[model samples]
Structure formats: structure tokens, C-alpha cells
Target: MQQLLVVGDIHGFPETFVELLDVGSFEQRVLQLADLSGRPGLRGDNLHDHLVKKDGLQHAVRALRETNGPPCFGIGFSSGGTALWSAVKEGLEIQALICVSSTRLRFETSPLNIPTIVFWGDLDPHRPTEIWNDAVPECCKTYAGKHHDFYRVDALAPNSPLRTDIGAFIESVSGLHSGGPAPAR
Candidate 1:
């Protein structure tokens, strides 16, 4: 029951955020660099580069579904939140969802009955807090801060409250972890 965490829309952030990942860091950066070098990486292109990470997330989810261990918690950031919501709606067994700076991709009656936490940077260029605040269900909580504030880089040091807020939210909702063993894909 290892909970599979699926991250969302990293875009080109991986190119410089190599220090974040503990595993597959180099390879992931190389792939992102390759994708950025080509025209396919442009926003909304829906090209081969997009599918690369898309496949990766899907594979990760499939593996988590197959695992039979401690109940796992899944966290999705930014566009990753969108994907997480999709998985939950599709009936993918997950303990929880932590979406940051993102929203639902389409308008549908979501089947996501699980506890969901949303972290939106107040000043994010794309997914601002106002856009997602009312859109998400009450079960989901949105943090008001700045874009990339979660990473705590110098650019966002002024709005460091987001980091602490996220930590607190996780602690508050962790007790609600539930659902049976993740189902097979």
C-alpha cells in the first residue's frame, strides 16, 4: 500500500532544480534539458516532450498501485495537482492529495472523495490563489503566498510563510489517511 505521489506541471523547473530529487536526478534533468532544447517544450504544445513526464508519472502510479505495504500518501504540486485529481476521479486508490499552485483540468463531476490539500502561491503567474480558491471543494485548503515559495529560494524568501503553512496543513490532515489498498491499474 505504498502511496504513490504524483507531481504536476514542472515544465522547465527540472533543468535547474536537480538538487531537489534524491533519485534519478541527473537523468531527469537531462531529459528536461533535452525537451527544453527542442521546440516541443513550448507551453501547451502537447508534444512528445510532454508525454515523457506524463508516462513517467503514470508508471509511478502503476507501481504504487502494485505495492502492498504501509498506507502511502500522495502529493502533487502545481500541474501535478491536476493529474492527482484525475487519478482520484478515475478511482485510483490514494490516501490523500496535496496539490500546489494548480487546478482541475476539466469540468466534470469529480469522484475524488478523499481528503485533498491544495497549496497555491498567491502570486503565481499561471495558477493564482483566486482562480483555485472557490473552484476546489471545501475538503481542499489553499495557501496564499508566492510562486515557487515552497522551494524557499532567495527569490521567494519574503513569502516564507507558505513553507510553514504547508507543513502545518500536512500535519493537520495526515490523521485522515484512509481508503483500502490501492487498486491495480
Candidate 2:
């Protein structure tokens, strides 16, 4: 059985992601990255560049249960997706990464140990596909609409087409166990 650990944006959207996971039948074995926010959505005085480098994730690395075994896959949605990429880059033992409507951080330059799948919305202000392409080796899944179209938070809006290919993408990327590190000069 493949265990998918779905991570949502650190800013806001943990509940939305959790609801989606439940609807997707992913109730067990999913991990949500917590926010260190003293007040919800309040980022405080931290520098913008270091925003995603959360102490919560760092602690997760230390407190993770080695007994449950490695997750078969990791799904990073929005900002959490990038965090997952960073965690993998920092040597976390994950099999693969699936990033949706997200960008790659500057530190994510080298080719990763596992394959990755990136989902991008054409109008997703974030311009996910463009960022991921420049930094990571991922199969890009582009939607004809915006970022929120891919998300099923409250409900799938009429304009948002059903994503029939995500499961397939996950299957494909998961099968690719090894890939070369990003090219070095």
C-alpha cells in the first residue's frame, strides 16, 4: 500500500488540504506541516527569504517515527510542496515528491534522489510550472485555469475541471526510483 503524506501551505489552508485528503480517501498516514505563527497568518518580522524555513519542519526531522517506515510518497500542495522539496534536499527519507501550484526555492538546485511531479495553473499568480522547470526535474501538469482550480477546498467550482490525470502522474513519478542530480559545472 502506498502511503501519501500530504502537506499544505504553511500560511493558511491546512484545513482545506485535510478536507481534500479525506475526500480523496487519504485519511491515514498524512502529515501536515504546522505553522509557528503566534497569530494565524501573521508572519511577524522574519525576513521574507527565510519564510519557508520553519522550525516545525526541522523538528519533524528529529521527531519523525522511524518505526512507521518511510512514506511511499509525498504530496506537497502549494507552499507546503516547496517545503517538502526542501526537506528532501536536506536528506529526509522520502520516496518521491508531488508539488502543486508551487515554486522551487533557490536552495533547490541539485537533482533530487526521488522523482517529482509538479502541477501548475496557467493563471496561478505564482507561475508554478515556470519556477519548477527552472530548478527541478518534474513532470509538469498544467491546468487550463488558475491555481485554485486544482484545489478542492470547499467544493470543486463549476469552472474548475476535474483533474483526471493526477493519480496517473503520481503513479508514473513514483515508479521512477532514481534520477541524475542536477547538472554541475
Going through the candidates in the order shown, the clash numbers are 8, 1
lDDT of 1 at 163: 39
Clashing pairs in 2: 111-182
lDDT agreement of model 1 with the native: 0.43
- Taken over the whole model, the C-alpha lDDT of each candidate is 0.43, 0.51
Best candidate, TM-score: 2
- Candidate 2: residue 45 Cα off by (Å): 11
Candidate 1, superposed: residue stretches over 4 Å from native: 1-8, 12-70, 104-111, 128-132, 139-145, 148-160, 176-185
The sequence of per-residue lDDT tens digits that candidate 1 reaches over residues 1-185 is 12334343445332333222221211211123223223333543353235344564454334334434444455555444555566566556766665655543324343357766555554555543443445554343334455543443521244244434444444445532223221110
Give the per-residue lDDT digits (tens) of candidate 2, residues 1-185: 55676665544444543323212333334444444222233332341223445454444433333315646667666656666777677666777777776554434565677877666666766553455565665556556655643564322233223233445544454443223222111
